[model samples]
Target: MTTLPTLTLRDGLTMPQLGFGVFQVPDDQAQQAVESALEAGYRSIDTAMIYGNEHGVGRALAASGIAREDLFVTTKLWIDDHGRGAARPALEASLERLGLASVDLYLIHWPAPATDVYLQTWQGFEDLRAAGLTRGIGVSNFLPEHLDRVVGLGGAVPAVNQIELHPALQNRETVAANAALGIATEAWSPLAQGAVLGEAPVVEAAAAHGVSAAQVVLRWHLQHGNIVIPKSVTPARIAANLDVLDFTLSEAEMAAIDALDRGQRTGPHPAEFNG
Candidate 1:
């Protein structure tokens, strides 16, 4: 079994650097997919209320019989639940769906900057953390300016910032900004939804490493110090994704992939996305 490396958050909590993501996974299939991931040695599971699969994920966790302490579960507060008053109830509803006493981390799903309530939402996150509803709190799809505001005025620095990052869309500036603030940078779409795998540079690196292009890209994420959550419902792919820890990407190979960035994004822009 491959043991994934853990990244310690600014709050001192540890998370598996390579984990499983359940985005776009249907509610009925989430349980089985998550079970496969857990069986493949993935200890961290990322989900969101918007995904509408929390109950299924919780079912898988309950059925796996895995010790609660050994698993790291993360769920996000949806865009509809952005206000300070709505935060706790939203999290509580997620907890109910997840059938867990508390999640490992809770993140604001998006900055929804146009709404102008993320600061209040951040405060709610802080309050939840203090109340023990979540071991740690963070934000997702948040730009540097959003992070700056939340940290500067919200009275707490986020422990993590989950964003869409891949070889083709490195978002280096956001990653650097998070690094400067001691926030863990987490890559949500680390493979670019299969875009990077077909890139010439990625293919060459995979051939040289005797690994799959997916592995090459995932390894690149690890080498670059970004926590990655690659989504796959296929058992073989799920297992293969976790196998990235075995190979090391050379400096030249890393740079070649870095050059592939064309600023393409598969997800919505943080600053402009109100939902």
Candidate 2:
């Protein structure tokens, strides 16, 4: 099994820098996909309530034969589960669905800026962390404004902030803000949903490094110090994604990819996602 590099969160929790994501995966197929990923040396699994595949993921984890301490499992609290009263039960439900005693990380799935309830949702996460139900609690799809509110609470802080990030949507401001507060940033849609896999810069970098374009993109995230969860159902791709730690990209090559940023987005704006 290949060993991926690890990153430490704000609360001193360490996570594999590269993990497997189960987005858009069907409920029935999640188990098989996760099984393949585990065999390919992925110890971290990222899922969400909205994904509706936690049960299948749980089944795979149960059968992985890997000890509980050896794995890092993360699930999110969906928009509907936001606020003080709803967050605890939702997390318990997620654990029930995952068939785990506790999740390594739990996140607020969205800011839901229109609803203005994320502050209360974050409070719930703080409570969960205090109670030890979740090792670490954080938020996803949160911009600087949302994060600032959490910080203002004073009792607890977000350990990680998962968000959509790729060459197209660099999120430099958010990254800076997270760094400033000692919060770790994790990248979802790290490959831009495969949109830039064939781009000239990424292809050239991959060719020079003797790796795949997908690996090149993932390496970019690692080099930038962001935790990344890249999803692939294909066995070869799953193995290939974890094979990036063996090589290094030159500063010039990394710069080329950085310059390719257009500020274009492949997902919905965080502020606009009501759900």
Best by lDDT: 1
Least accurate stretch of 10 residues (summed lDDT) in model 2?
1-10
Model 2 spans with C-alpha error above 4 angstroms? none
RMSD of each: 0.7, 0.9
Task: Give the candidate number with the greatest TM-score.
Answer: 1
Predicted candidate 1 versus true structure: per-residue lDDT over 128-203, tens digit per residue:
9999999999999988898889878838899999999998898988998999999999999899989778998899
lDDT of 2 by residue, 70-159 (tens): 999999999888789999999999999999989999999899999998888888888898888999888898899888988998868888
What is each predicted model's overall lDDT from 0 to 1?
Answer: 0.93, 0.91
TM-score of each: 0.99, 0.98
| lDDT, model 1 | 0.93
Q: Number of clashing pairs, model 2?
A: 0
